[model samples]
Target: MLKHVQVRSSSSLLRPGGQKADTLSINSNMSFCSLHEPALSSRSSSYTSLNETQSSTGSASVPAAPPTTTVKVYTRCLRPDLEYKTMSVKYTTTCRDLVDQLLNKYRMKHRDPNLFFLTMEVATRSTGTAVRTILVLDDDSCPAQLQACYPRADSKFTVRMRHGGLVKVYDSVLMAESQYKSLLVSDRTSVDQLVQLLLTCYKSNESVHNYSLYEVCRTTSFERKLHADDRPLAIQQEWSSLAEYSFVLMKRPPGTPRSGRDFPLRRSFLQWSRNRELASWSGREISVIEERRSKSHRSPSLSLAPARKEGEKSFYI
Candidate 1:
C-alpha cells in the first residue's frame, strides 16, 4: 500500500514569534530621465582659457567640472542577447540616471522603467581573505562615488529587474546545462508562487506538488532544498553572487519528508535583506561528481581542442 504524502502551502509558515509573512510592497513610481552628454570639448576650452588668465594675472583659477569615470553595466535579466553597456558617469550620477542611460543605449521602448534597478558586486579583503558581496543600490545612491570609496577593492555594476524584487531561476538538473529566467517577486512571494510562475513560463502541465526548488552553489557544491513557505527572492537578495549561486527547479525525490519546522521565518530576513552589509551562507562542503573524459582526451597534456566539444551541453535546457 502507498502512503500519501502531505504538502504544506506557503501561507502556513510562521514567524519567529508566530506571525504571518509581511504584505507585498512594489515600487511603481520610478521616473525615467533623458540622456544628456557632457560637452567635453567646451569644458576643455574653458579650462584652457582659465589657465591662460591665471598665468597673465596672479588670480585664483576656478575648479574644473566634476571628474567622470568610465563604467560598464551588465544586464542578463532585461535582455540576454545584450550583455552589457558602457558609458561615462560623474561622481554625481545616481542609480536612476544609470538605468535611464542603459535603456537609451539599448533603444528599449514600451517597457516600464520602474521594473529595473541596479546592483553592485564588490570584492573586499577581510583578515587576509577575499570576500565578494552583492549590493542592491537605491535610486538616490551614487555608484561612481561608491566605487571611489572602494578604490582598493574590485567593484562591478549590473542592472537587474526589480518591481517588488526580480529573481533569476534555472530549470536544468545540472549547473553547466542551466539557463536563467527572470521573475518579478516580493518578500511576500512564497516558493509555491514562484513554482507556479515557472510552470507558466515553461508551459509545463505537471503538478506543482511534484516539483521542488533548490538554492545551488556550483563553486562550493552546496545546495539547500527550500521550504514551500520560503520566499525565494528574499533568499536571493541575501546571497553573495548570482553567478556562483542560483535557484534551480528540480523534481522532488520520491517519499521525501515535508515539514516547516526546519524553515526560517520570512520576517527574520528583513533585518539584513537590503542593507549595505555583506551576508553569506555557510554550509558544510560537499564533494562534486566529475564528468569522464573521452579516450582521445585522456592524456593530461595540452592539445588543440575545439571551443566546444562535440558532446558538450547547450546553455539552454
Candidate 2:
C-alpha cells in the first residue's frame, strides 16, 4: 500500500504542531492528499497518472477563495476599544466666523456628523422644547450681542437672507412688510437658513431676531420621534413662522395663533400642545422676543450676523 501525505499551505492552522500529522486519515479510493500539516509534507509521489478534482467539477485547475471585506461600521461617541458614558450632541456652527466661537468652545470637527449631532443637543437639560418666544435685535442691540457672543469679530455685523425660517429668509429689507405686504420666493428652503436667521437677530443696527439652535434641532428631533399629520401638505407663505418654511424643524413663533397648514408642522404643533413631544431641547431655546421689535416683527427675514472673513468663510464648512 502506497501512503499519501497531505499538506496545508500555511503553518498557522488551529491544530497544535506535532499533533497535526497524527490525525491524518487515509482513503484508498482517493489518491488526492488532504492538508493536515504543511511543515512535514515531502514531494513523495510514485503513483499512477495524477488526478485533481473538485466536487463541482473534476477540473485540472481550481481557484482560491476571495478575501472578505472589512469596512468599519460607524457609530456614536463610544469607541469600541474603550468605555464611556453619554456624549452631548453637537451642532455645526455656521460656516461663518461666529462658528469659530462655538467650534473653539467645544472641540469638534466641521465634517463629523456624530460630533455635530452632539453640539445640537448640548445644555438642553431644562425647560420647554417649543420656545415660541422671540427676540428682537435692533442695529445697536445686535452689535452688542454679537460682540458678547463672538468677541473675535466684534466689529463686523451684516445681515443676509441665507438662514432662518421662510419669514427669516424673506425678512430681507427688500421683502420687509414696510417695503411690501408680501413677496414670493421660489427658491428651495432649508433649516440651515433657519439657524442663520437666528444669528442675525443676535446682532444688528435695528433690532435683529434670534434663538437657540437646540430648539430647531428639537423641533426636528420631535418630528423624527412622532409622525406628521394626515392633512394635505402645502407650503403657504402667509402662515405663522413655523408653517412658512417647508422644512420640518424650524421653530414656530411664540404667541402666534395657529392655523391649519401642512402635514408635519400642524401635526408637530398638536404633539407639542399635548406634551407628547420630547422636551429635551428646551434649554436650547434663547430669547429673541426683545429683538422682534421695530421692522423685525415682519417675518420671512434673513440673518443680521456679520459675513465671514474671505478665507475663514470656507474654512468652517
- Model 2 C-alpha lDDT per residue in residues 1-317, reported as the tens digit of each score: 23556643544445554543334344444334347534324433312123222434655347754332211111223233433222222222232333233334344322212112111111222465622222323322322223334323212222222221223232334223432112222233223333333333434333212211111122223222212222212223322455433322223356532233333352333333223222332432213322553447653222322333464321100
Residues 192-297, candidate 1, lDDT per residue (tens digit)?
7778767755566777777887777675455667778878867787665678778888887778654443325552222322221112212221111012234344
Model 1 segments more than 4 A misplaced: 1-63, 164-317
| Candidate 2 minimal-lDDT segment of 10 residues | 113-122
Q: Which one is best on lDDT? A: 1
Clashes of each: 0, 48
Reference-based TM-score of each model: 0.33, 0.15
lDDT of each: 0.66, 0.29
